[model samples]
Target: MINGILFRQRTGLPWRDLPACSGSWKTVHDRHRRWSADGTWERILRAVQADADTEGRIDWSMVSVDSTTCRAHQHAAGASTRAPKIPGRRRSPARHRSDEALGRSRTRPDHVGGDKAYSSRRNRRHLRRRHIKHTLPEPRDQRANRQRRGSQGGRPTGFDKTIYRRRNEVERTINRFKNFRAVATRFDKRA
Candidate 1:
Protein backbone atom coordinates (compact mmCIF):
# COMPACT_ATOMS: atom_id res chain seq x y z
CA MET A 1 0.00 0.00 0.00
CA ILE A 2 2.86 2.38 0.82
CA ASN A 3 4.48 1.50 -2.45
CA GLY A 4 1.23 2.20 -4.27
CA ILE A 5 0.94 5.58 -2.63
CA LEU A 6 4.56 6.43 -3.41
CA PHE A 7 4.12 5.35 -7.01
CA ARG A 8 1.10 7.57 -7.42
CA GLN A 9 2.95 10.51 -5.82
CA ARG A 10 6.02 10.05 -7.96
CA THR A 11 4.15 9.60 -11.20
CA GLY A 12 1.14 11.82 -10.56
CA LEU A 13 -0.96 8.88 -11.73
CA PRO A 14 -4.63 8.60 -11.01
CA TRP A 15 -5.33 6.46 -7.93
CA ARG A 16 -7.22 3.98 -10.10
CA ASP A 17 -4.12 3.52 -12.22
CA LEU A 18 -2.03 2.20 -9.34
CA PRO A 19 -0.67 -1.26 -10.12
CA ALA A 20 -2.35 -4.35 -8.64
CA CYS A 21 0.96 -5.55 -7.18
CA SER A 22 0.85 -2.67 -4.75
CA GLY A 23 -2.52 -3.79 -3.32
CA SER A 24 -5.83 -2.14 -4.03
CA TRP A 25 -5.47 1.52 -4.97
CA LYS A 26 -8.54 2.34 -2.88
CA THR A 27 -6.89 0.79 0.18
CA VAL A 28 -3.70 2.76 -0.35
CA HIS A 29 -5.59 6.00 -0.88
CA ASP A 30 -7.70 5.44 2.21
CA ARG A 31 -4.67 4.80 4.38
CA HIS A 32 -2.99 7.93 3.02
CA ARG A 33 -6.03 10.07 3.71
CA ARG A 34 -6.36 8.71 7.24
CA TRP A 35 -2.68 9.14 8.07
CA SER A 36 -2.55 12.66 6.68
CA ALA A 37 -5.68 13.71 8.58
CA ASP A 38 -4.34 12.29 11.83
CA GLY A 39 -0.87 13.89 11.44
CA THR A 40 0.77 10.48 11.31
CA TRP A 41 3.07 11.62 8.56
CA GLU A 42 4.17 14.65 10.60
CA ARG A 43 4.87 12.42 13.58
CA ILE A 44 6.93 10.06 11.48
CA LEU A 45 8.97 12.95 10.13
CA ARG A 46 9.61 14.33 13.61
CA ALA A 47 10.60 10.92 14.92
CA VAL A 48 13.06 10.40 12.09
CA GLN A 49 14.50 13.86 12.63
CA ALA A 50 14.85 13.22 16.35
CA ASP A 51 16.75 10.02 15.66
CA ALA A 52 19.06 11.83 13.32
CA ASP A 53 19.62 14.60 15.86
CA THR A 54 20.45 12.03 18.50
CA GLU A 55 22.94 10.48 16.12
CA GLY A 56 24.52 13.92 15.55
CA ARG A 57 23.74 13.68 11.84
CA ILE A 58 21.26 16.56 11.65
CA ASP A 59 22.49 20.11 11.10
CA TRP A 60 20.87 22.99 13.01
CA SER A 61 23.41 25.64 12.11
CA MET A 62 21.36 26.86 9.20
CA VAL A 63 18.06 26.20 7.43
CA SER A 64 16.08 27.88 4.68
CA VAL A 65 12.41 28.65 4.25
CA ASP A 66 10.67 29.33 0.97
CA SER A 67 7.43 28.58 -0.80
CA THR A 68 6.60 27.56 -4.32
CA THR A 69 3.27 27.44 -6.05
CA CYS A 70 2.57 24.18 -7.80
CA ARG A 71 0.06 24.57 -10.58
CA ALA A 72 -2.88 22.41 -9.53
CA HIS A 73 -4.33 20.09 -12.06
CA GLN A 74 -8.03 20.44 -12.91
CA HIS A 75 -8.68 17.36 -10.83
CA ALA A 76 -6.87 18.92 -7.87
CA ALA A 77 -9.58 21.52 -7.31
CA GLY A 78 -12.69 21.42 -5.09
CA ALA A 79 -11.50 19.67 -1.98
CA SER A 80 -13.81 19.63 1.03
CA THR A 81 -13.48 22.82 3.09
CA ARG A 82 -13.78 21.13 6.47
CA ALA A 83 -10.60 20.88 8.49
CA PRO A 84 -9.55 17.37 9.53
CA LYS A 85 -9.27 16.90 13.27
CA ILE A 86 -6.14 15.21 14.51
CA PRO A 87 -6.91 12.07 16.52
CA GLY A 88 -5.63 12.25 20.09
CA ARG A 89 -5.65 14.45 23.18
CA ARG A 90 -3.63 17.64 23.15
CA ARG A 91 0.13 17.16 23.44
CA SER A 92 2.76 19.41 25.05
CA PRO A 93 2.27 23.16 24.66
CA ALA A 94 5.38 23.43 22.50
CA ARG A 95 4.33 20.55 20.30
CA HIS A 96 0.83 21.95 19.93
CA ARG A 97 2.20 25.36 18.91
CA SER A 98 4.86 24.05 16.52
CA ASP A 99 4.38 24.80 12.85
CA GLU A 100 4.11 21.58 10.89
CA ALA A 101 4.57 23.45 7.65
CA LEU A 102 8.22 24.06 8.64
CA GLY A 103 8.74 20.30 8.65
CA ARG A 104 10.55 18.23 11.30
CA SER A 105 13.09 20.69 12.60
CA ARG A 106 11.20 23.23 14.66
CA THR A 107 14.35 24.47 16.39
CA ARG A 108 15.53 27.87 15.26
CA PRO A 109 18.43 27.69 12.83
CA ASP A 110 21.44 29.89 13.38
CA HIS A 111 21.05 31.27 9.90
CA VAL A 112 18.53 31.16 7.07
CA GLY A 113 18.86 32.06 3.41
CA GLY A 114 16.07 32.75 0.98
CA ASP A 115 15.29 34.54 -2.28
CA LYS A 116 13.93 38.02 -2.80
CA ALA A 117 10.41 36.67 -2.91
CA TYR A 118 10.67 35.87 0.79
CA SER A 119 12.03 39.29 1.70
CA SER A 120 9.03 40.87 3.35
CA ARG A 121 9.06 43.03 6.53
CA ARG A 122 6.75 40.60 8.32
CA ASN A 123 8.90 37.59 7.46
CA ARG A 124 12.03 39.41 8.55
CA ARG A 125 10.38 40.38 11.80
CA HIS A 126 9.34 36.80 12.40
CA LEU A 127 12.91 35.65 11.93
CA ARG A 128 14.13 38.38 14.22
CA ARG A 129 11.72 37.28 16.93
CA ARG A 130 13.07 33.75 16.64
CA HIS A 131 16.66 35.03 16.68
CA ILE A 132 17.41 33.33 13.39
CA LYS A 133 19.92 35.23 11.27
CA HIS A 134 18.71 35.60 7.70
CA THR A 135 20.25 36.52 4.37
CA LEU A 136 17.59 37.86 2.02
CA PRO A 137 18.21 40.46 -0.65
CA GLU A 138 15.76 43.31 -0.86
CA PRO A 139 13.71 43.61 -4.03
CA ARG A 140 14.81 46.40 -6.37
CA ASP A 141 11.66 48.42 -5.92
CA GLN A 142 11.84 48.22 -2.13
CA ARG A 143 15.47 49.28 -2.19
CA ALA A 144 14.66 52.25 -4.34
CA ASN A 145 11.75 53.26 -2.17
CA ARG A 146 13.88 53.13 0.93
CA GLN A 147 16.59 55.22 -0.67
CA ARG A 148 14.10 57.79 -1.85
CA ARG A 149 12.93 58.24 1.73
CA GLY A 150 16.48 59.22 2.87
CA SER A 151 17.51 58.58 6.50
CA GLN A 152 13.88 58.40 7.60
CA GLY A 153 13.52 55.14 5.67
CA GLY A 154 15.69 53.46 8.29
CA ARG A 155 18.98 51.82 7.48
CA PRO A 156 18.83 49.30 4.67
CA THR A 157 18.45 45.76 5.92
CA GLY A 158 21.77 43.96 6.19
CA PHE A 159 22.63 41.81 3.19
CA ASP A 160 25.56 39.52 2.64
CA LYS A 161 26.24 38.80 -0.99
CA THR A 162 28.46 35.84 -0.16
CA ILE A 163 25.88 34.24 2.11
CA TYR A 164 23.04 34.99 -0.28
CA ARG A 165 24.80 32.97 -2.96
CA ARG A 166 23.92 29.88 -0.97
CA ARG A 167 20.26 30.54 -1.74
CA ASN A 168 20.81 28.43 -4.86
CA GLU A 169 20.96 25.40 -2.59
CA VAL A 170 17.41 26.07 -1.45
CA GLU A 171 16.31 26.56 -5.03
CA ARG A 172 17.98 23.32 -6.04
CA THR A 173 16.32 21.47 -3.18
CA ILE A 174 12.93 22.77 -4.27
CA ASN A 175 13.73 21.74 -7.82
CA ARG A 176 14.49 18.24 -6.62
CA PHE A 177 11.10 17.98 -4.86
CA LYS A 178 9.45 19.24 -8.02
CA ASN A 179 11.05 16.37 -9.88
CA PHE A 180 8.20 14.25 -8.51
CA ARG A 181 5.39 14.88 -10.97
CA ALA A 182 2.64 14.77 -8.36
CA VAL A 183 4.39 17.44 -6.27
CA ALA A 184 5.39 19.52 -9.27
CA THR A 185 1.85 19.58 -10.56
CA ARG A 186 -0.32 18.99 -7.52
CA PHE A 187 -2.71 16.23 -8.52
CA ASP A 188 -4.23 15.58 -5.12
CA LYS A 189 -7.55 17.32 -4.67
CA ARG A 190 -7.38 17.30 -0.90
CA ALA A 191 -5.73 20.35 0.58
Candidate 2:
Protein backbone atom coordinates (compact mmCIF):
# COMPACT_ATOMS: atom_id res chain seq x y z
CA MET A 1 0.00 0.00 0.00
CA ILE A 2 2.81 2.38 0.87
CA ASN A 3 4.60 1.62 -2.38
CA GLY A 4 1.41 2.12 -4.34
CA ILE A 5 0.69 5.36 -2.58
CA LEU A 6 4.26 6.61 -3.12
CA PHE A 7 4.18 5.55 -6.76
CA ARG A 8 0.96 7.46 -7.35
CA GLN A 9 2.35 10.46 -5.51
CA ARG A 10 5.70 10.41 -7.36
CA THR A 11 4.11 10.06 -10.76
CA GLY A 12 1.29 12.48 -9.98
CA LEU A 13 -1.14 10.10 -11.62
CA PRO A 14 -4.89 10.29 -11.29
CA TRP A 15 -6.42 7.85 -8.80
CA ARG A 16 -8.15 6.00 -11.59
CA ASP A 17 -4.88 5.44 -13.45
CA LEU A 18 -3.09 3.61 -10.64
CA PRO A 19 -1.85 0.18 -11.73
CA ALA A 20 -3.67 -3.05 -10.79
CA CYS A 21 -0.55 -4.40 -9.09
CA SER A 22 -1.33 -1.98 -6.31
CA GLY A 23 -4.46 -4.05 -5.60
CA SER A 24 -7.52 -1.79 -5.72
CA TRP A 25 -6.38 1.80 -6.11
CA LYS A 26 -9.28 2.96 -3.95
CA THR A 27 -7.86 1.19 -0.90
CA VAL A 28 -4.43 2.74 -1.35
CA HIS A 29 -5.95 6.17 -1.99
CA ASP A 30 -8.17 5.88 1.07
CA ARG A 31 -5.26 4.85 3.25
CA HIS A 32 -3.14 7.75 2.03
CA ARG A 33 -5.99 10.20 2.60
CA ARG A 34 -6.67 8.86 6.09
CA TRP A 35 -2.99 9.00 7.02
CA SER A 36 -2.72 12.56 5.70
CA ALA A 37 -5.79 13.69 7.67
CA ASP A 38 -4.50 12.04 10.84
CA GLY A 39 -1.16 13.91 10.71
CA THR A 40 0.74 10.70 10.02
CA TRP A 41 2.82 12.31 7.31
CA GLU A 42 3.80 15.19 9.54
CA ARG A 43 4.70 12.77 12.31
CA ILE A 44 6.85 10.78 9.92
CA LEU A 45 8.68 13.91 8.81
CA ARG A 46 9.30 15.02 12.40
CA ALA A 47 10.58 11.59 13.33
CA VAL A 48 12.96 11.53 10.40
CA GLN A 49 14.16 15.03 11.17
CA ALA A 50 14.75 14.08 14.78
CA ASP A 51 16.81 11.10 13.73
CA ALA A 52 18.84 13.22 11.33
CA ASP A 53 19.45 15.81 14.02
CA THR A 54 20.56 13.14 16.46
CA GLU A 55 22.98 11.83 13.82
CA GLY A 56 24.31 15.35 13.24
CA ARG A 57 23.19 15.16 9.64
CA ILE A 58 20.88 18.18 9.93
CA ASP A 59 22.33 21.59 10.66
CA TRP A 60 20.41 24.03 12.86
CA SER A 61 22.75 27.01 12.78
CA MET A 62 21.43 28.66 9.65
CA VAL A 63 18.25 28.79 7.59
CA SER A 64 18.47 29.51 3.88
CA VAL A 65 15.50 31.00 2.04
CA ASP A 66 14.98 31.65 -1.68
CA SER A 67 12.08 32.12 -4.06
CA THR A 68 11.33 30.26 -7.27
CA THR A 69 8.29 30.80 -9.42
CA CYS A 70 6.31 27.64 -9.96
CA ARG A 71 4.63 27.69 -13.33
CA ALA A 72 0.98 26.64 -13.29
CA HIS A 73 -0.83 24.89 -16.10
CA GLN A 74 -3.15 26.97 -18.27
CA HIS A 75 -5.96 24.71 -17.04
CA ALA A 76 -5.23 25.65 -13.43
CA ALA A 77 -7.94 28.27 -13.68
CA GLY A 78 -11.53 27.73 -14.90
CA ALA A 79 -12.78 25.61 -12.04
CA SER A 80 -16.46 24.72 -11.95
CA THR A 81 -18.50 27.19 -9.89
CA ARG A 82 -21.02 24.46 -9.20
CA ALA A 83 -18.55 22.64 -6.92
CA PRO A 84 -18.86 23.54 -3.25
CA LYS A 85 -15.88 25.11 -1.56
CA ILE A 86 -13.89 22.96 0.84
CA PRO A 87 -13.96 24.50 4.28
CA GLY A 88 -10.48 25.29 5.74
CA ARG A 89 -8.86 24.90 2.33
CA ARG A 90 -7.13 28.15 1.40
CA ARG A 91 -8.11 29.87 -1.85
CA SER A 92 -4.59 30.59 -3.19
CA PRO A 93 -2.00 28.83 -1.06
CA ALA A 94 0.86 29.61 -3.41
CA ARG A 95 0.41 33.35 -2.88
CA HIS A 96 -0.90 33.31 0.69
CA ARG A 97 1.24 31.22 3.01
CA SER A 98 0.60 30.04 6.55
CA ASP A 99 3.06 29.19 9.30
CA GLU A 100 5.13 26.29 8.03
CA ALA A 101 6.50 23.27 9.90
CA LEU A 102 9.83 25.00 10.57
CA GLY A 103 8.00 27.98 12.07
CA ARG A 104 6.69 25.63 14.73
CA SER A 105 10.17 24.55 15.77
CA ARG A 106 11.27 25.66 19.20
CA THR A 107 14.85 26.36 18.18
CA ARG A 108 15.37 29.43 16.01
CA PRO A 109 18.12 29.45 13.43
CA ASP A 110 21.06 31.75 14.25
CA HIS A 111 21.33 33.04 10.69
CA VAL A 112 19.23 33.39 7.54
CA GLY A 113 20.41 33.61 3.93
CA GLY A 114 18.04 34.81 1.26
CA ASP A 115 17.92 36.05 -2.33
CA LYS A 116 18.07 39.68 -3.46
CA ALA A 117 14.33 39.58 -4.06
CA TYR A 118 13.90 39.08 -0.33
CA SER A 119 16.21 42.02 0.37
CA SER A 120 13.82 44.57 1.81
CA ARG A 121 14.09 47.05 4.68
CA ARG A 122 11.00 45.59 6.34
CA ASN A 123 12.45 42.09 6.14
CA ARG A 124 15.74 43.24 7.62
CA ARG A 125 13.88 45.06 10.40
CA HIS A 126 11.92 41.93 11.23
CA LEU A 127 15.09 39.87 11.34
CA ARG A 128 16.73 42.49 13.56
CA ARG A 129 13.78 42.35 15.94
CA ARG A 130 14.11 38.59 16.03
CA HIS A 131 17.88 38.94 16.63
CA ILE A 132 18.63 36.66 13.68
CA LYS A 133 21.58 37.40 11.42
CA HIS A 134 20.77 37.62 7.71
CA THR A 135 22.61 37.64 4.39
CA LEU A 136 20.45 39.31 1.77
CA PRO A 137 22.00 41.50 -0.92
CA GLU A 138 20.27 44.81 -1.48
CA PRO A 139 18.78 45.44 -4.93
CA ARG A 140 20.45 47.93 -7.28
CA ASP A 141 17.61 50.47 -7.06
CA GLN A 142 17.66 50.32 -3.28
CA ARG A 143 21.40 50.89 -3.35
CA ALA A 144 21.05 53.89 -5.66
CA ASN A 145 18.23 55.36 -3.56
CA ARG A 146 20.20 54.78 -0.37
CA GLN A 147 23.17 56.56 -1.91
CA ARG A 148 20.90 59.39 -3.00
CA ARG A 149 19.91 59.94 0.63
CA GLY A 150 23.59 60.43 1.56
CA SER A 151 24.01 60.65 5.35
CA GLN A 152 20.27 60.02 5.90
CA GLY A 153 20.54 56.70 4.10
CA GLY A 154 22.86 55.46 6.88
CA ARG A 155 25.70 53.05 6.26
CA PRO A 156 25.12 50.28 3.73
CA THR A 157 23.62 47.10 5.09
CA GLY A 158 26.37 44.74 6.25
CA PHE A 159 26.74 41.92 3.76
CA ASP A 160 29.31 39.12 3.78
CA LYS A 161 30.56 37.88 0.44
CA THR A 162 31.48 34.51 1.95
CA ILE A 163 28.11 33.89 3.64
CA TYR A 164 26.16 35.00 0.58
CA ARG A 165 27.71 32.18 -1.41
CA ARG A 166 25.92 29.68 0.81
CA ARG A 167 22.59 31.26 -0.16
CA ASN A 168 22.64 28.99 -3.20
CA GLU A 169 21.81 26.08 -0.90
CA VAL A 170 18.19 27.19 -0.80
CA GLU A 171 18.15 27.61 -4.58
CA ARG A 172 19.51 24.09 -4.99
CA THR A 173 16.94 22.76 -2.57
CA ILE A 174 14.17 24.38 -4.61
CA ASN A 175 15.58 22.85 -7.79
CA ARG A 176 15.54 19.43 -6.14
CA PHE A 177 11.87 19.83 -5.23
CA LYS A 178 11.10 20.81 -8.81
CA ASN A 179 12.20 17.34 -9.86
CA PHE A 180 8.82 16.14 -8.63
CA ARG A 181 6.21 16.33 -11.37
CA ALA A 182 3.50 17.89 -9.19
CA VAL A 183 5.81 20.67 -8.01
CA ALA A 184 7.16 21.49 -11.48
CA THR A 185 3.76 21.46 -13.18
CA ARG A 186 1.60 22.88 -10.36
CA PHE A 187 -1.19 20.59 -11.51
CA ASP A 188 -3.48 21.25 -8.58
CA LYS A 189 -5.78 24.27 -8.71
CA ARG A 190 -5.56 25.38 -5.09
CA ALA A 191 -1.78 25.68 -4.72
Which numbered prediction scores highest in TM-score against the true structure?
1
Estimate the TM-score of every prediction: 0.78, 0.76
Candidate 1's displacement at residue 12, Å, is 1.3
Error of 1 at 171 (Å): 1.4
Query: Model 2, which residues run further than 4 Å from truth?
Result: 74-106, 188-191
Number of the top candidate by lDDT?
Answer: 1
Q: What is the lDDT of residue 71 in candidate 1?
A: 75
lDDT of each: 0.73, 0.70
Q: Clashing residue pairs in candidate 2, if any?
A: none
Worst 10 residues of 2 by lDDT: 89-98
Q: For residues 84-167, what per-residue lDDT tens digits would candidate 1 score against the true structure?
A: 432222221111123344454555667888778778889888999988898888999989998999998767888888877766
Candidate 1 stretches with Cα past 4 Å from truth are: 77-106
Q: Which ten residues in a row are the worst by lDDT in model 1?
A: 88-97
